[model samples]
Target: MHGYANPARFLRLAKLLTAPLLIGGGLLAVAVLAWALAAAPAERLQGDSVKILFVHVPTAWLAMGGWSAIAIASLSELVWRHPLAGVAARAVALPGAVFAALCLATGSLWGRPAWGTWWVWDGRLTSMLVLLFLYLAYIALADAATRDGQGQSRIPAIFGLVGAVNIPIIHYSVLWWNSLHQPPSITAGKSEMAAPFLIGLMASTLAFSLLFGGVVLARMRAILADTQAEARLRRRAMNAADV
Candidate 1:
């Protein structure tokens, strides 16, 4: 990890890995989605609406996973002074927020048919909404800190760490509260899903995970380049002032 602390090393790696991940992930996603939509049988109860699961589940997983990345990067920044940690956190914020929003939108669509309502203040849903708001807030705070020339500001890092508390709440919400949402279906070697659905879901998840990683790395590379350019301009200005 420390080896990646060098921006040049990291940028070279990001460049090499980005295209393969993006292309491979995109192909896998398209193929699995086609399979889920066309070949996979519908759920016994939900019928055709169950097809949404392939898209919704992956977005939901990535939403949580994205924030987890931010929290880890923030921790590294604060605790280890990892040089690229802030860049990593910034790189992930937008994608994470997008995924969270997608989760909310898709969940609402799924809920409308399954729960007979377009929206509900269920524990799991509500907590996930809060997670979206937290992402937006973090994005704003981080941007403000950066613009203020406090690039290494600990405020955003601290907030990132605190926001992680919501993750566990989101995970356990269904178990902890009376909700319309179902409990764990694929935990502890017990799965309610049949083989077809399970395979499709897993494939979609792997595809999205690859795509997400590529996006994060690409964004990190861009951020590093901008930071370097800014530093160079500042140095030139200081030298001109000295003259």
Candidate 2:
């Protein structure tokens, strides 16, 4: 991990991985989506409404996963002083927020048919909404810090770490509270879900995870480039002032 602390080396690896991840993820997503739409059998209970699981489940996982990444990176920045950690945290914000939004939208769509409503204030749903707000707040804070030349500030990192508390809450909400949201169909090496739906969900999850990783790397590279360009501009301004 520390070996790639050097930006040049990290950038090289990111360039190599970014394209493959995006391409592979895109192909896998199409395949999985098609399988979900056509091949996966309709659930006896939810019928066609179950189809959205392929999309919604993955988005929900990534939404939490993205924040988890931010939390880990934040820890690295604070404890290990990793140079790229802040970049990682900031880069993931937008994608994480996007997934959170998608999760909510799809959840609503799924619920409309299954739960007979477009929205619910259940524990799981509310916590997930809180996660979305956290992502937005982090993005706004990180962007403001960058614009104000406080990009290296510790505030955002602290927030990232603090916001992680909600992750467990989101996960255990359905279990802890009486909610319309179903209990986890998959658990410690066991699954109550039918085989076909499980298979499709897993495939869709992998594809979305790959897509998330690729986006994060691309965003990291962009953040680095912007920082480098700003540094160059600063040097020129200093030189001009001296003359």
The model with the greatest TM-score is 2
Q: What is the C-alpha RMSD of each candidate to the true structure, in Å?
A: 1.1, 1.0
For residues 144-219, what per-residue lDDT tens digits would candidate 2 score against the true structure?
8788776546889999999999999999999999999999999998999888888889999999999999999999
Steric overlap count per candidate: 0, 0
Mind giving the per-residue lDDT tens digits that candidate 1 earns over 1-243?
998898888888899999998898999999999988789998889988888888888998899988998999999999999999998999999989998998899888988889999889989999999999999999999999999877547999999999999999999999999999988778887889899989899999999888888888889888888999999999999999999
Report the C-alpha displacement of residue 128, candidate 2, in angstroms: 0.3
- Candidate 1's TM-score: 0.97
Off by over 4 Å in 1: none
